[model samples]
Target: MIDYQLDADGLATLTWNVADRPMNVLNQASIAAFTKAVERAISDPSVKGVIVTSSRPEFVAGGDLDLIRNIRDVAQSMDCSGPVSRILRRLETSKKPFVAAVNGSALGGGLEICLACHYRIVADDPNIQLGLPEVTIGLLPAAGGTQRLPRMIGIKKALPYLLEGRKADPAKAFEAGIVDAVVPSSELLSRARAWLLSAPAEAAIKPWDRKDFRFPGGSPQSPGPIQIFFGASGALLAKTQGNYPAQEAILACVYDGCQVDIDSGLKIEQRQFARLAISQSTKNMIRVLFYDMNDANRLAGRPKDVPKRSFKKVAILGAGMMGAGLAHVASTAGLEVVLLDVSGDAAEKGKAYGAAILEGQVARGRIDESVRDATLGRVIPTTNYSDLADCDLVIEAVFEDRAIKAEVTRKAEAAMRVDAIFASNTSTLPIGGLATVSKRPARFVGMHFFSPAEKMPLVEIIRGAGTSEETIAEALDFARRIRKTPIVVNDCPSFYANRAFAMYPYEAMTMLAEGVNPNLIENAGRKAGMPMPPLALIDEVSVELLYKAMKQARADQGSSYCAQPQDAVLIAMVEQFGRLGRKAGRGFYDYPSDGERKLWTGLTEHFPRAEKQPSVEEVHERLMYSQSLEAARCVGEGIVSVRDADIGSLLGWGFPSFLGGVLGQIDTVGLPQMITVCDRLAQHMPERYAVPQILRDMAASGRTFH
Candidate 1:
């Protein structure tokens, strides 16, 4: 995998190109080959210095997660990280200068390898990212990242990249001193060779290994670093709520390791990595977030017989936030978008949304002005249905009303190609029911994009009863085209994500109706690792909207509908009181124009706090079990698969990555224990807490979701 070449000038070049893999990863086999190549260069009298580069598009993708996933103990974790760490350390101190010519994105172990070199240079490609982002996947950088990065930059400057797993492009990386230089792709290798050829013997030795070397800013004990560490620890606790051990472990590694020599610091990093690597949470995260998520993105469940589809031009019906956001993503993906609305002005306004977002990206230096203009130019806003005549796909993102959706569906189909797919961006409405209005029901499917569609990572592809395999494939293709993770689910009310996620807010409101303190309810949700507390989440989504959805469901299902305990609170917030939501500047919490939002003082008058309140642990369990149980029901009902359920839960909503999504949470809580807890909880709310038969069967068979 490592191709070694030597020039007459005594400069060795090692190019990494792993066979059968898209990107080079640090695994046992690859690491062994790399070590052999490095050793050869170090021992050869003809070799004076070395340049490390990649033949693949990306320098390296990081460690082989498959290898890391199987690590079950501390020894195994050490075995996985130790050899690579030692090899990198040896390369830096071999008395021969080494330079990393990074051609593309280098992350985690990849960036660690770059740090080991005497000098680092990268291609000036906007897509080339450099960072140690191991904490995001529930592990720290075990191969000398935590130590070398802080030393290369400083404690203050490096903490964000290390702890938060933030990545930077070539310019930002060069500015932050993560890279020594940024050059054109053509000059990458030549520049590395030039630097290595001119370097003195002292350049081979790292600053940390020198006798008189001082830290870039100050040592770990200095007042500035101490304050930064304290603030970082507190911020990490507040953000992660102590659920993610990787962040805490990373902090400890940087704090403790920076105080010692480089060798000792590497050992400290390895130990911290081992502790996190062997933990169940880490394993769960790697399994779901990495493997399962990759599977979904690859459309693993797509019908085998159907050929893949590619969308060229897409027409979006309506110019609201969802429609505009869809237009932005479609245009960005190089598809011509026809943004249609009832009025010409309304359509223009929708197109402006994409322009505003692109402008912001340009202002932030995320994209070039030329790229922004090109993307904006792809969107054609108008009121004419004829604009959609040549579109390959047409999605109706109009209001969530049957009549309005039916009107747009009929109109768009009339002007579109006979084989072109039609979809609805519905969050709760059933695609099967909506398909009744379509002339070609087989082509009708649900492409449910979450709010601010361009940003959300997930696109729930709902398959209607009549949706053809080809249509499903097309929807999956479109979702993939926009680089969004696609999870296929059978059509039902709320499909999968909304059905399972609704339980979170409902449970919180039920607690409020039971006289539980609002603050305690909100805290329970946050401590459970949810992105937003239930009350605040509902306010953002709007209490009036929830009330309307509840009313519609009650009307549709008639006597079959089961009223939730939260229904009374929803009605009180919307009708009895004038509290609509955040839009109305009042709801469960007041949204002042000048200050942070807090719970409405009048909440106590309507729902008095109980003399004896539920424990925070109890509240946390209730909220978690409620949502997870619903997710299990979705799996049992065949609405979604176990993998999709987990992936959807994590990406669709902000289900904590550390918990490994909803079903993974159940597996984490052993099935037997989960069922027992559900039985206990069933006494309070039997209908809501009822355990699905799938969990009981899995428990009986001693099976886990993974």
Candidate 2:
């Protein structure tokens, strides 16, 4: 309902409160209500000023995303422009000052609504963000925003915001001309009233409509903007690699809107926005990055229902790369950390890792010198177990040996408080076995931080059979506190990601044995959207680790490890030839500090390049699909943590983020088709490429991986 109240000062306050919703959103009902309220304020001579506010936590969130998602017909979507722009035009034309008081977030159409008003005053709530982020979701501002925002802020500044689709902080919003002022929550209404009272109680057409308004970089009569439109179109295609459609749609809307009158411009916007909203890229982006991602992070599978996780000090038990990175992140998050190792020098080396990273961040302007110093100061290094006595959590990121891990677990358990959590960073060892070494097994769990923990986001929290609910919740909370995405997984081989991911390198190494050029196989991996090809990935992992993983696979899989043609080749290289890997400057590739990484040319005589060029498609499938099929089997066999399996793949390994997750990629490409491709290729791929039962079931039921 369009309810309006006018005070004796001739100031009319129109409040929007959508029933059964926490935030105000623009939809047909709200738009209709807005039109009615605006008409009332315009017709009443008693109303000298109009105040638009929300009676909810958020001033205005945006348009209903579900409504946008259903807009498949571009022409029908275009029709929405007529009434929307008409109301905005009418409100602008009303001979009364219109001011918006944003009590919370003002985003998308919400921000567009504020742009239609004369001025905006926003609450300074830290939770509040203000911007037009339509581009990121595969759409653009359609309700006269493309036309108005640029007119207010100038083209260059507005273009970056529209293209990138980032929500700005309140202060940033004010500075960027998206909002005029920011006020604290308690004084939001009074500050808004003061501004409204001081503003001239009259309205005029916007500065853009003035006869003398000249768009910067272009005269209204010139071809300058035309050059920009064509230039920007090319740049968008180049940067996005034609992988996204939002940038093109945004550019098209703005270019057309700028040259036309406001009435006709709205039509162009609605049409482009609709087409973009339904494009494959946009649909996939919203499903993966927004909906499913939110679902993954919010899941609570454990019994804890723990209210809070308290940990003021953290102790890391190993001074290796993973342990040092854990110390860095913990200290940076305002937790006092003690880095301990077997000896004093080892502990000192771990502290150096934190110092090196922080110093570089300071140099790059990512963190100030004081912040860097503060972070480094929080991480105290020592070899003494006494230093870990008061620590609330002790994480051991050591080798994968079961014996070593069990020993470390006992030591960590003994050093910390009885209630403190002891986490093992062992990727492949049985967490249950390690927990058995602890007296308080309920307080022990697995906090598997991927190598280079500071950079990687996902932390796989493995719940040991005896781990307490409180321990799991506290570990998950600790991961979040350090700005990481954490997923809870039942302990099993590889947990989820690395276990399935190790298959790719094995497949690539197998291909190398079949006379495929090592570089060609690696190049195919990269073209398939992997950050590194298998050989390069193996080098980064070190040759000794790959050999150990292969050995483990052989022992576990038995018949599943039935030798493919290339398995014999890697086995011979690692066992018979004594050519370990990058350490020896040889393996599948050669490396020296100063030279370009190239395949060992001499090995070409030993393993010749294949006479036939396998299509990049064929090569990518053999390498990537083998791992995906194994991942499906792992999921079916309860080796993976369900619900978040795909996100785990991306963060644990470099599974492509654009594909959403591994299963999401399968769904996007059609799981049935993927299964068919894998099955057909299995003839030559041995056990690695064989389609798993899960894929077969999904194919039969026509179900997606999600």
Per-residue alpha-carbon lDDT of candidate 2 for residues 1-706, written as tens digits (9 for 90 to 100):
3457888878888888887554677877888888899998989988778888888878778877656656666665665544666788788867577888888888888888889988888888767888888776667887877878877776666787788877887888888877888888787767767777787644445666667776665632367656666677787765565556778777777777777876567778767777876565666566656665565566455445687776799999889899999999899899999998999899999999999998898889778998988888899998888888899889988777767877777776667788788899888776887777789889888988887888988888898899888888888878878878877777876677776787788778777777777777877887666768788777777776767766776776788675545466667678876656776777667777889778767668877777886777888888777667767777887766545677677667867655656766777678867877887887876567777787788788877765
Per-residue error (Å), model 2, residue 696? 1.7
Q: How does each model score on TM-score?
A: 0.98, 0.84
lDDT of each: 0.92, 0.77
Model 2 misses residue 210 by how many Å? Answer: 3.4
What are the candidates' C-alpha RMSDs? 1.5, 4.3
Those runs of model 1 whose alpha carbons end farther than 4 Å from true positions after fitting are none
TM-score of 1: 0.98
Cα lDDT tens digits, model 1, 520-561, are 999999999999999999999999999999998998899999
Task: Give the Cα error of residue 178 in candidate 2, in Å.
Answer: 3.3
